[model samples]
Target chain A: MTGSVLAGFPATTIRWRDQLDTPAVVVDLDIVERNLRRGAEFAASASVDFRPHIKTHKIPALARAQLELGACGITAQKVSEAEIMADAGLDDILISFNILGRTKLQRLRALAERVRLRTVADNATVIDGLSSAFSGTPDRLGVLVELDGALKRCGVPTVEHAMDHARKVDRAAGLRFDGFMIYPAPDHWQDALTFLAACKDAALQAGLDPRVLSTGGSPDMVKFAPDANVTEYRAGSYIYNDRALVSMGGASVSDCALTVHATVVSTPTPTRAIIDAGSKSLSSDLFGLSGFGMVRNRSDADIFALSEEHGHIEFADGAPAVGDHIAIIPNHACVVSNLTDHVQFVRGDYWVGEQRVEARGTVQ
Target chain B: MTGSVLAGFPATTIRWRDQLDTPAVVVDLDIVERNLRRGAEFAASASVDFRPHIKTHKIPALARAQLELGACGITAQKVSEAEIMADAGLDDILISFNILGRTKLQRLRALAERVRLRTVADNATVIDGLSSAFSGTPDRLGVLVELDGALKRCGVPTVEHAMDHARKVDRAAGLRFDGFMIYPAPDHWQDALTFLAACKDAALQAGLDPRVLSTGGSPDMVKFAPDANVTEYRAGSYIYNDRALVSMGGASVSDCALTVHATVVSTPTPTRAIIDAGSKSLSSDLFGLSGFGMVRNRSDADIFALSEEHGHIEFADGAPAVGDHIAIIPNHACVVSNLTDHVQFVRGDYWVGEQRVEARGTVQ
Candidate 1:
């Protein structure tokens, strides 16, 4: 508990194991390593290249650990995140979102020059932006056509649109069409495999070699068939399964590695208790869950709501007393990682150290 | 659009107004000043002291501007945030949240020693912790008893509990019972006023002076009676009115000072378009609103959902084409301000400068 103060506040680095602070993200090192090994083994058994997304942990140490555990590369949703991994000496990265504008393109080119950088595109405009930026570059940027498997957030709608974008990438200068990248919804593995197979056939018809058919979602990663057209699997939450993952049947509650350690600050009524962790710490991402998070070992208590700095917990039986510490598995782990600057690492019953969320707040 | 690269990524500074980047928070400086003036004028006309919460705009420059425009003092919700403001030379800060534990109490004492720091406590344990930390210290910490007006998040439940905490603060060593602070829900102003009057009467009967009666909520601040018992009003979102404020009938859409500028990245279907600003950029704080955010000047579009890095916009009419920039008024602006490291400042139509969210992640 003795550490130097940071900005007139308690140092985030906790030294004592017994005096765990409230509203701190605590990662069980043993569980995290086990989760990483399990994911790598599953991908290996299926003969798929494992590429864990750094967007989940956002910690360079954990990214390096994943690479050492047989991950082929790392996946990032933003170019800024890729740069952070690059600074941490992770050479291979995939920016799995469409990036636009001249300023972003110039930065992407610079990042590509520094690392084995690949990007995803679903339309001609984004492809044009990438192609124009990398037209005269020494290192050709690897491009992956993003196809909408089920989630219609950001991807080409049909196989024809995917092939069209792939063809554009294939014909463009200073760009190498790697393959197709699809993030499918849960239980849509058959549809995703079918789409990938058709996309591979379209690439062959167009005389383009589709080397990487990357597809993944934590819920379906372990369910992928060995003979599927997918060549690489990308999963972020597998390293630290959340309540959302557990609710989706991706992992058992025992497999959840990260927990928001919060102290109950108020017990206003028999059924209601307020925890120190709020939306600022636990995040407001429901991820289709009924509540904000799940209280570990306290199934009777439900974290039903959250304000900016207070989480409301409703108990089925009796509420926790004030000053009682409770561990919460947040609804979405990735958003929680993005919300904090550091996380406490716990080994067994002792807090070993703190990991800096280096890639946090890199929204641009 | 030319700025020095930051960690191999494009700097989040907008050089030209026309070339402003997407997925950025743009603050209308003129509108912000007007909002500040309007709020200060409203509080002044009611003879109530105005204390704007820094949780809305974490930037110290904006906080100083608010102080310059007649804000009595600044309010912070966390000890870490108060420390940041103290570092920026804000002399008076009221941390309007119950702080517990040895580490936080020590930090609170240090902050109080440096500045005129007052904190809220609803229970005796918290007051005891504060008293123990401040015992034998030169500066006594001002303590406010929090009353639960309507929000059951963090406050004393009944009048008896309020008086009990107030008496505890009055008798505690190295503590000054300043007054009462209550965050009343909209339309519950009468109840809060009555509660404050009762507390004031109790304090007088106990031979103690209740000098400050602090009550605030942006939605109901405009409806406070001139002769109300509230001596001061605290508000955060009034400085930069948001969609939630508009929906609550607090401010007009034209009066909103903050807007999230995002680029249309995808138009997968006729009715579906995706913006680059997702939960990471705009945040997922619905604040009782129907959607994630309101697309400014585009009533035809509804930002119904968000992923980690993309916003799903369902359009009633024709959607905006790819690469088009759209302004979004987020449901909760405070959460949006906390998500980003920096925000773009706009004066009229020109890009002026960038303001760093200094207290962005100070959520301890």
Candidate 2:
């Protein structure tokens, strides 16, 4: 109510006597800027254009921060999300997911009219649907064939399927076959490169140039360079390292920009404590994690379980007394961001500002 | 943008055309009302007051609707949530979470001054903290001793510890003893009830009447009702059936008032389809569930994996085509509601409206 602990207020500006509400989300802008610079520098060193995925933060201010730090573009997973960024003046978006449904396709076409929009598809049916939806449109729509690396979620299983989809995409008049896209499975860079080479061979056989090969995944981005046949990097969540990223040795807790600032509400026993943040704020995606997530300062504590609004913490060292506020780097950053409308930005001891999660609730 | 799909609209006017969007959450108001009425009626039939916990929906409108349907008071898990609901002019709130920290306690004392605020504490430290914060204040802060069930989370482990803390709270000048509160562990209801009774006996031994006996849970509500020991019910998620509740046979999918409407983006193979609704929209809390969640109408299919913004559905019954929409009942409705800003409402083929998740970011 006092707006004292609101996001973006400089921590240095507050008196030590001021109270900090528990279960609040805290974002370190210094770490966030460093992370952005590090990721952009990595892409620059690899000779690939850095187009950070905005889905992780879903805040226009953060997107602008990435662009100001030299990001070539931004990637979105939905037309509605893209529209949200586009409204905030972010153009050149690569929609990472396949766009379907007449209503959604209509929205995407409208968005393409406002911004340079690119998307992915793994089959001819989707391409045909896009073609039908964009008939008589003069704006060029970039198309990418998604490749499967180690994760078996989306994309074509093999290079042949990728080529088949690419060729079919080429055959569609309203759609342009630009290149290939792959969401790497568990940081398997070697498999992804091998798959990309196969895609190049198939494209060559079909007499098409796969000029815009995009490979993305924060875990495997370091191993992926231009020589690996990747021309663009679409890594997201790198600006805010999470527990999964830290466990995979991609980033450290110090590099984690976003943290759930939870207070110890109850210390029922010497070994147990409960925090106010739960599955809702911290998220339930384990990402193959051993526990709930990583807690800063209290690394010995394990998050045993999360109810809707309460998190059960088990510590081996000592239980945190009631009123202690601890930082938690979630298992996944993107999902955590989706649960809130805004986050506070802090610099060292100063909490300087706040930013709304502008693209939140754009579910369409 | 069409008002039909926009977030924060009132729920009395949604349209059928909005279902084309993937991963959009929907709540059935009729079923929700039915669930509320049934729960309140059952509580009345058993001669108990129903204090419907609003932590599940986090919407003041929904909480107001519940109050109109016979709920004694609304339950909140955070001071910020209670403050927001109170700001909306709704009073008689029970802050169900343990209050900690100086800044937070100051805020809690401020809140107690505004409404009939009641809260729980499990330790002597918190009781002393509250006493210090509310020193010299004439307002009475009702204090409940949170007793441990089989959950092993927050609460006093033994009856002696509970009574000892209760006596300390009774001696506090600014706080009033208000009985006991327990979040009963599923399958351990009888034992917890017996422990609570023993704690009450100890309270009586200390010359205190623990008149307020609050016990409730989505999984164990039915089991706890017959014991006649719990004088108040504090259930929340029973209003919206989720995978966990459905699996526990607490409510059916038809009784489920919450669902995510997702568009099928890709049908790459006969056995696989990708949807727009993923963990960001539907949350990944399986609650020991076998899959991510359950898809309605497409019962044979399985929602197996989520990648931030994409849900992978595997089916031997053949793939859903691109552009098709499907409904999903998340494993945990409370977490899913926390993921988005609002939900669409529908009734018998008629598109009704939208409702804002008023308490979405009230982490404190």
The top-ranked prediction according to DockQ is: 2
Worst lDDT run of 10 residues, candidate 1 chain A, spans A1-10
Docking class for model 2 is: medium
- Tens-place lDDT digits, model 1, residues B1-364: 1221111222334554577877789888778877877887888887888899999999888888777777889999999999999999999999998889888888898888789888989877788888999889887889999998777777887778888888899889999999899888767878888889888888888887788899988887677667557888889999899998998889999889899988888888878889888999888888888889999888988888899889999999988888888999999999999899999877667676777889998867
TM-score of each: 0.95, 0.93
Tell me the tens digit of each residue's lDDT in model 1 across A313-354.
Answer: 898989977778888999999999999988987766766677
The number of clashing residue pairs in each candidate reads: 1, 28
Chain A TM-score from candidate 2: 0.94
Tens-digit lDDT string for candidate 2 (A205-254):
88998988888889876565566587888888898888888888888778
- By summed lDDT, which 10 consecutive residues of candidate 1 chain B come out lowest? B1-10
Inter-residue clash pairs, candidate 1: A1-A16
Per-model CA lDDT versus the true structure: 0.85, 0.80
Give candidate 2 regions above 4 Å deviation: A1-19, B1-20, B225-228
lDDT of 2 by residue, B1-364 (tens): 1122212333444356555355678887768777777676777776777888887888887787777767788888888889998988778888877887767788888888778889999988789888888768987689999998778778888988888899999999788999999887878777777987888788888899898888877676655454556778788898887888989988877888888888777776778888888777777888888889898887888888987778889987998777777888888888777777777666646566666788876766
